[model samples]
Target: MPYTPVNVSLTLTNQQYVALRTVNGTVVLPPGSSGRPDAGGLKGIIVVRQAGNSYLAFERNCPYRPFDACALVSVDRSGLFLRDSCCNSQFNLQGQVIGGPSPFPLRQYSTSLQGSQLNILN
Candidate 1:
């Protein structure tokens, strides 16, 4: 499924600069924390910090039913995978389908880290 192009650039200056949404609005995502900010991709972006300075970015749009409004994927509470309530599809952080009826993996964006700048693109 075609999705809105994503090009997100984040500058990490300190431990409290990363923003992530929560029940009480926005909160800080530490240098190693993973969360969905209220921007980027088709249904927003899920940013996951991997080993060391590496990171992974995935589109929140579920591939099962791309046009469905509820096809958006969110990080499951355990922070282990992404799930779509619309079709009950589950995907790993790498965007591979792990459960449910999804036939395709979540769209992954390319990421490049330069100094303190993290750029995600697709």
Candidate 2:
């Protein structure tokens, strides 16, 4: 079964969001991330920064075989996709499966950007 993380409500300052400002830039936060149970009982969160201040956040565990924490996905060398080395699955910045065994896209979280704070909400 695929893991669905807990609800998330996070605020990021411009300075903090800078690191993830570029395309394919990623940040992983622990399960109890930003002081909340964001990852439910799974490993953590995998966030990929996209253009237009949009962001994509999903559980670190790969949907193809989430039971194995080692199946977590990482940004490919090209910085264009998230690749799960274990399963050789590749997901686009938007969490959609581009090349992989996963039948569904990565689970996503809602995000919004204000003057400077970027909020990741459930």
TM-score of each: 0.78, 0.73
Worst 10 residues of 1 by lDDT: 24-33
Q: For residues 9-96, could you state the per-residue lDDT of candidate 2 as single tens digits?
A: 4455535445586776777767654465333325566777777677777766778877876777777877767888999988887888
Model 2 CA lDDT for position 119: 56
Cα lDDT tens digits, model 1, 1-122, are 86576666777564553532222112212211233442477667677776667677887778897898888788787777779989999987677999999989988789888988878788
Which numbered prediction scores highest in TM-score against the true structure?
Answer: 1
The residue-level lDDT of candidate 2 at 44 comes to 67
Q: Which candidate gets the maximum lDDT versus the true structure?
A: 1
**For residue 68, what is the lDDT in candidate 2?**
75
CA-RMSD of model 2? 3.1
